[model samples]
Target: MTASKISFACAPVIALLGMAWGIAMAISTDHSTAPVHAHLNLLGWVSLFLMGIYYKLHEEIDGLFLARIQAIIWAAASLLIALGIALIHMNNPVGDPIAAVMSIVLFLDMILFVVLVAKSRQ
Candidate 1:
């Protein structure tokens, strides 16, 4: 399938994963768990697959640029999740700071992606 189509496919998967995460979080009543669970859906299953489609559809974007941005997403997401989890599990690790940085990076990446896609349509 084309990359853009992959994005559509991934969106729901990510959403569903999000739901699962919510369910797990709700059922367990345990406040101390690794935040990796959130990232698993947000980055791994959701972002990876969604971005696959975004890149596929927004064919105008530089493949290399998108790939690089995606790599950054994965790195940041994973890092943030790891740190967040640590923080959640009773550690004051650099969780919030790291997650915040990654969130900003993700925003930048999305903006860049949108720009490239728009330019490509021209």
Candidate 2:
């Protein structure tokens, strides 16, 4: 599927998962994983959905290989960061390294997005 389609398809699923997670936390009265939930919503739902809309509006760049790469990387990194944060909250030492690396990956994905947007006609 196209990058835009992939984004559109994945965003809602991620959002639903995030919402469920939030509700679960609320029920359990444990907010320690709040950061992970926030990251899932922001990166998975907000950022992905916004990028999908942008791709939809700007057809010129929608089909570019780099756009697809950016979308995939963003999605993967989002999940990775959330997992890392969750693990850290669980007191796992490896979580720190995972979170650190994924954070950089997410940042680089955003940079790739910036380049794609800058190069696009619209």
Identify the candidate with maximal lDDT: 2
The clash numbers for all candidates, in the given order, read 7, 0
lDDT of 1: 0.59
Per-prediction CA RMSD (Å): 4.9, 0.7
Q: Give a tens-digit lDDT track for model 2, residues 14-96.
A: 89988998999999999989998999999999999999999999989899999998998888888889999999999999999
Evaluated at residue 114, the lDDT of candidate 2 is: 94
TM-score, cand. 1 vs. native: 0.55
**Highest TM-score model number:** 2
Candidates in order, TM-scores: namely: 0.55, 0.97
User: Which stretch of 10 consecutive residues in model 2 shows the poorest summed lDDT?
Assistant: 1-10
lDDT, candidate 2, equals 0.92
